[model samples]
Structure formats: C-alpha cells, structure tokens
Target: MQSPAHGRRLDAVTGPFTPRTPRVVAARRLHRRRDRDTAGRFLAEGPQAVREALDRTDTVVELFGTPTALDRHADLAARAARADLPVSEITDEALAALTETVAPQGLVAVCRHLDVPLRTALARGPRLVAVLAGIRDPGNAGTVLRTADAAGAGVVVFAGDTVDPYNGKCVRASAGSLFHVDVVRAADPGAAVAGLRAAGLTILATTGYGDSDLDDLVDHGRLAAPTAWLFGAEAHGLPEELTAVADARVRVPLHGRAESLNLAAAAAVCLYASARALR
Candidate 1:
C-alpha cells in the first residue's frame, strides 16, 4: 500500500517498510557495535530470539517480520498486539540486507540493550553467579550465560574485557537465555571481584593452579554458600592477580588424559556443581 502523503509503500497490517527508509537504515546499523551502542539498541533475529525479546516487552523497541513469517508466528504477533507493539513487515530483500547471517529465520527485533551494572547485580545478593573475566569469545560468553540460566544461577556477569553481551553472535548463542538472566558488564575486573566479595559472595576462581578441587568443594559441601564462579578466557584462563584475591581457587579434576575443558564445558561443570551443592 502506498501512503497518500508520502507516496511510500506501507502495509497497513504489517506496516510494510522500504529497504532504504530511515527506520530500516538505522536498524541495519545495529549490526555495528558502535551504532548499537550509539542507539542503545541491538537486533534480535529469528523466531525464538524475537519471541524471547517480546516476552520482555519493555525491553523491545520494535519488531520486524515478513508477512509469511508473522503468519507462522501468529502467537507472537498477537502478543505484540496485546503489548501495543506493531510488527513491521518488510520485503524479504530488506530483511536479508539487514543481517549478516547467511539465512535469517524471517524475524528481527530491535531491543534495548539489557545490561545492568555490577553494583546493581551484586546488590541483589545473588546465590549462584558466573563471572567471565576478560573473555573475548562471544560464543564462550553466550554459552556461559545459557549455562548459568539453566543451572538456576541468579545473574551472569561479563566482567573486564569480555565481549559485548548484546553482540548478534553472542545473543544467538545464548538461545534466548539472554532474556532469562540478569546480564551485566564490568569494565574494571578487580573492582567487580571486590564488589562481589563485599556482597558476601564467596569467590571461587576456576584455575589450573587452584588449591581447591571442584569435586572436593562439592563433596565437602563448600559450594553451598552464596558463591560467584570466576571464569577466565579459554586460552589463558584466569589472570593471577584476579585469582589471588578469590576466596578459593577451584580446579576441575580430570580423570582422563585430556588437557583441559574448553571455556563452555568448564563453565557447565562448575555451575552445575554449585547448583547441585546449593540444592
């Protein structure tokens, strides 16, 4: 449908938009970190990610989808209507142009960045939390977020030089767990660790050189207390300075000849250990 005044194609039901429109251009720019940061928004693509974003209605700025995609996800459109958010239907060409993925799931949503501060997260008095210290890999970071959410942890902190939690890859890797947990970023890793300690959370640093073993902590019931697990990068592990301040440097015991667990695997083992102990 063409607008009477503007002469632009607009779908009444789906709010059809053109590829070169200002709204579309701005949303496409979210593909860049600088633009996303500037607009305080990021794109959540695919049915699951968009649905999850809509579940947190206040966080979703706008939703875009194709007519066919909206029909398939009728419930999402209905919910969006209930929340008073219109689902903008755009041309397939425009949707394809908006994302970097080879094939999109036909839906995209612009969501307000949902990260909080370390102080706010600490003030919640969270019981089980995962702290990523200087983790650069977005996949590893997102996997940890999902694992933390699954283990019933309270929050996931991307501390220090961690990847942007709102990055498209990280968000997709989280598989909607991004909306399930309280995510935060801390520019200063040491300060974040100190804050956690100050909040009465026993810091358990995962390191190869740790004095305490993870199994011992679980078997001995040491993980029952409110604790924060500090996970470093996949390649280098935790920094010595950060581990030095932790209440306990805990290591996952390996039975086989394997070198060590990857970042995500290590996080799953550690988080579930705490979850079981706390249960």
Candidate 2:
C-alpha cells in the first residue's frame, strides 16, 4: 500500500479508511447529489472524464489520485498543478474507499455543478430539446443526455423520479458531454412542460403505439419552432397525463415484431431525426 501526506485526511492507508463511519459514508453519498442543487458541487470520476471536466469547467474543487494514476494522466496533473487545484494523493485502497465504483480508476474530482436555468438554455433558440420524464436508470438517462448533446439539442430536462445525472455510471456513459450541454432537474413534470410551452416549444411525446409514425409526422425539412421530445420510462412508457399534454404523439416506424426500442436508443433516434428535420 502507498500513502502520502496531505492537508486534510491521511494519504491512503492500508485498509478502507476504517470504513469511514457509517454516518460519514451516508453524508458523502448525499453530498454527491445535493451538492449540485445546494452548493453547485458535483462529482466526476475516472481520468478521462475528470480531465475533460477540468478542462471545460472552472468549478473543480479537489482532484484526487494515486501516484500511478497521476503518471497515467500527466496532462491532467499538470493542468491541476498550474491551476493550483487541491490535489490529494492517497493509496489505491483509499482511492477506492472514496469512489462509488467497486474498481476505482484512481481518479475522482469534486467540481461545481452547473445549474443553468431553463430559460437560459433556451435563449439561443434551440429547435430541438429532449425532456426525460421519470427515467429511473442512470445508464438510460446518461445515454439520453449524450444523444441530446450529439443531436445538438439545447438542453436536457429530467422531470420527476428520474435518476440522478451525477450518478457515476451516468457521468461515465455521457463521455464528458455532460459538461458541454445544459442539464436541468425539474421540480415537477407539469411545471416543466408548462414552462416549455410558455417558451413556445412544442412538446412531442414518443410512444410505441402512437397513430402517427415519426417518419410521416415529422417533416425533417420543415420542423416546427422549438420542439421538445418527451420520452418516458422504458417499462411503463410515458404517463398518460404527460402524453395528454403533448402537441403530438409520434412513434418510430418498425418493420419487425420487436415490441419496442430501448429508451436510450429511442431517444437518440428521435433527437437525431428531429435535428435532421430542422436542418
């Protein structure tokens, strides 16, 4: 085991930092999520992702790594050094203790979370946006955000019962696009939809059994002004209330007998198609 001297906690010691008292562990978990809402703090892990976040945002608070990990990510270390970022060197075991994953990648970052207002994201006049309602899977949510970013959507809204965007898996899957796009967490679904409507954004719900096929209903060449594609959970689909408020319900044309597409896949197709239509 390797350890180093640091300002706060001892460098990674032999074991898992004495199990970090149950209360402390619980508090850190809460911090991961609440930090975003309350203090504008978020956690980014893994060398590549942390490096990306550090390069893009000025919100990084602390950078944690082991000697081997730092060697592998010399560029990031150099940047951190130049910025005077608080760096903590610990043993591999200690790094694992602070990480959410079973196999820690030996790097984790505490960064200031972005809380862009919905209106601010819409300011540039985005014609396509993705509104995720009640998406419970972190992987699914991350994929949706990634797709939205790729499709050039202005923002992604997580409305009601959705998985935390800061979840380690989601952050990893997003491939640092999470730093590039606007991600907003809504207090309620109805309010979010209402806000979009007020912004002159048309809400389109994606359903497996909609009467209008996405191919036919959406004229790629003549997309309507400011559109928001609404996707529901994979298992339950969108709630009836949400679907009811949509300006239109669209379904992807499927030639096969497959019941439905995965939520993330469906979101990507919808966002891409919508973006293509606008262009």
Candidate 3:
C-alpha cells in the first residue's frame, strides 16, 4: 500500500511523448482503471476538459482531435503547440475509440493523474476539505468535486471504496475543477480522517438522520474553522463505523417538503454553508 506522502511527483515530468497517430492507440487503453493507474494517466475529453487540462502547466500529456474538432476549436491546437505538447489529428473512428460520450466531442487529452497524498494536502493547511469515502458513482463524485471547488474547498479526498478520481465520467463531471483542487485517494478512510483531525480539521459527516442541522452549524460559527466533510455511498449513505468517527452528523433541513436532496445537492448545500461561514 502506498502512503499518502508517496503521492508527490516532486517535479511534474512532462513526458516527451508523441502521439504517433491521432488515434493514439495508447490513449484507447486508458479507459480501464488498471491501465490508467499503470500509466499514471487518464483521459479527458470535450473542449471544456481538454481546454482546462491544457490551461494548467504540465498537466496534459498529449492531445488528439478530429480535423473538424481542431478546426472548430483552433485555439486548442495552438495552445498545445505553444506548450510543446503533442497534437494528433485523428479520424472520427479514432475519436469514437477515445471517448465514451454518445456524441463524441472529437477532442481528447491524456492527463497525468492529479491525486496527491493526504499528507500533502494537509500540509497546506486547507480550510475546507471534502472526503468521498465509499462513494462508487463517478458522476456524483465529480459533481461533488465541482461543488467543492466552487465552494472554495482546496482538497478532495477519494477514500476507501470511492470511485476513481480519474474516471472519465468523473473528469467530465468535475468540469475542469479536477485540475483546480488538490486530490487524495486514500485506501484507508480511517487514516485519512485521523490525518485530517491531526491537522486540526473538524470532521463532519453528512447523513439523512444526523443529530445536527446544517444551518445551525453555520449559525453557531462551528464551520469557521478548518473542517473535513465526509460523504458516503449513494445507496447506503455513511457506514455506522465511519459515521461514529465524525465530530457531528449533519443533515440539510427540508423546508420545501422535499424528502431529500441527492448526494450532489446535499453536498452543495453543506459545502457552500461552510464556505459562507468561513468567510
């Protein structure tokens, strides 16, 4: 098992890679987690993701595009060239292979993995952190990440059985916030929580039947300090064992007669509340 601190790249080694063909047979293999993990890379498709990935220095590995896509978004190729990154002109069939979208965006970029060790994120003295423990849905996880980034959370932890941070759906769902925030993929969520606590972050778990109310926490200024918010699986919510470790279990109040909000909605409410209070 890799420790949290092992997550550092020391220096971002921009690989001197050339996309021999726009098809990038190399990128096609990255659809699987094992392939992505082994290569230390993942795929980001669409103009938005490709654009954002390229905006960050040393993040994009190689870029692939159909002529139509390149022509439609000409600036992307220029950006890639300026960065001295490989740009491959591929066929529609190749774009089909590289992307999972029903309507392929005709653009794909190979990106270096963004996850760092929990220790690295903690060392930064992050005021807001979002922990996705036992979350298996990539879309939900990605949405939460987007929300976290919007709410000023500097770090996001994908712990235990959580979805891969590099999952294609997750990358698109993050809408480029994946590159904006520090990420931690912890095998042991308990250790992740312990490290956060050790770093002086108060852990608050979100559950439907929690003892504390979301508005009340903000009202009391309880969220003004460094804090880690733990969110659980979509179907089962947080486990008893995990929930027991929380300083508090918080629920969003339902004033509109809505039974509940989905994972993403609830997260947005909680994270924003904390964001507002911390300000």
Candidate 4:
C-alpha cells in the first residue's frame, strides 16, 4: 500500500528505525562476529545481498533499509512484501552503524547462518568441492566461494582457523554465491579431510611445494573423479598437518616468472580444471 503522506509511493510510515530502536539494536549486535555466532545470524548488506538472502526460504529474518533505498529498489520491496517480512525504515546513521563499510549500502538484512554440517555437504556425492584450509582472508575466502560456484562446485568448506564465511566483507565478496552453494565450517581440519575422503572425494591440496603438478594431473585425465581442492592463506600455504592428510599435494605449474598465485586465482584454476575434466 502507498503511504498517504505526501503521496509517497512507499509502504513505510511513521518514524524511521534508529540505532537505539530495540529491533535495530538487536540487528546491530550482529555486527560483531561473536554475537552473530551466538544468535546464529549475520548481516548481509546491499540490495543484491538482501535480495539473494530473501530468495532463500527462512534465510532472512528481518530487512532494514532507508526510505530512499526501498524506493530505489521496489522489486526488493515487493519480494520482502511477498515473504511478509517486516521491512523497517531505518535511518542512514543506523545503517552505517550496522555495517563495516564507510559507504553503507542503505539496505541490510539479518540472515540465518548459511553453513551446513560437513557431512551434509559431502553427502549426495558431490563431484567438486573447495576447502579453505586455514584461510585467513575473508575477501579471498569469499572470492574462492564465488569461483567455486561458478566452476560448478557443489560445496565449499571453511576448515580450521579460517575466517567466518559470515564476515561482512566475506558476504559482500561472495556476491550472493554464499546462498548459491553448500558451505561448511569444520573446526577440526583432520576430521574434515577424513570425512571428505570417506565420502569418496579425492582431497587435493593446492600448494607452492607439492610432489604432483596440477597440469600433469589434468593431462593424465585424473581430474574427472570427485575432488576436493584445499586452499590456504597466500603468505603461508596449508599447515603441515593439513597438507600431510591430503590425498595429493598438487601445485599449479607457473609457466611465468612469478613464483605463485594468490589463493583465489589458484582455487579458480584448480576448480575449473576439475569442472572441465568432469564434464
């Protein structure tokens, strides 16, 4: 329904929600990783993230946006309306307070954590998976998740001391792919590797130092089988113990003078290689 005030085409009326508003306060609490973990929810900003979060059933708990943001993205407003989700009109300052970005997207959605148990992800015979083993960068982790989805991977597991997939930067970096693929966070890297192997996935660790070369594996047509690619932080590759558990440690052959590829690029090359071989 259109607001009767000043012939505004918006559905919201009355006062815009502020940072101090109780519900807004609760949503704002998600800004911290600890509170988000405790509440089993995280914040997704921008119209794209909010729209994607809304697409999944029961994924979005509440959506808050500025009047201008809602006005600009009516399709999102309609989607929220169809879900019967409460769309609170929030002030700009409130939105900035809820986000880590200097330029707030003007829209934010409180979403249920997107991760599933590792077994659930490995079940159903996944042909391709990306395991972020001790990945410390949220941006890289998110980028790898996006690349995994694009490369036809069915799941992405965040293992060991990896950053939370729900980190604000990570969620934004995923570009909504967080909702597109199965995500797993395993605190124990060893058990995660074992589970992947038990599920019949060949665990390949991507590292600068490896006995096997990725090109050789592809050339030999060894990439057709179900595979899980393990990626680590760029500065320091996979931990020694984690690397030891891998079925094979494979390095992407650098034909160039450059010594190594960053985490995201390496993951894309490895995942796409398997995707092509599988097809």
Predicted candidate 4 versus true structure: per-residue lDDT over 47-140, tens digit per residue: 8899889888899987788888877877786677667677777788788888888887788988999899988877767899998988888999
Query: Positional deviation of 183 in candidate 1, in angstroms?
Result: 0.8
Ordering by lDDT: 4, 3, 1, 2
Full-model lDDT for every candidate: 0.84, 0.75, 0.85, 0.86
User: Considering only N, C-alpha and C atoms within 3 Å, which residue pairs clash in candidate 1?
Assistant: 11-16
Enumerate residue pairs that collide in model 4. none
Which parts of model 4 are misplaced by more than 4 Å? 1-14
Return the TM-score for each candidate structure.
Answer: 0.92, 0.86, 0.89, 0.94
**Top candidate (TM-score):** 4
Where does model 3 exceed 4 Å of error? 1-23
Give the TM-score comparing model 1 with the true structure, all chains together.
0.92
lDDT of 1 by residue, 1-279 (tens): 533222223466545676876788889999888988899999999999988888784888777777778778877766665676656778888798676689897888889998888777777778998998988998888888999999988789888888889888999889999998889878888998888888889999998767898988888889889999999998999988899999999888988998888889889999998898888
Report the C-alpha lDDT of model 3 over 248-271, residue by residue, as the tens digit: 999999998887889998999999
Higher-lDDT candidate of 2 and 3: 3
Q: What is the Å distance of residue 83 in model 4 from its true position?
A: 1.5
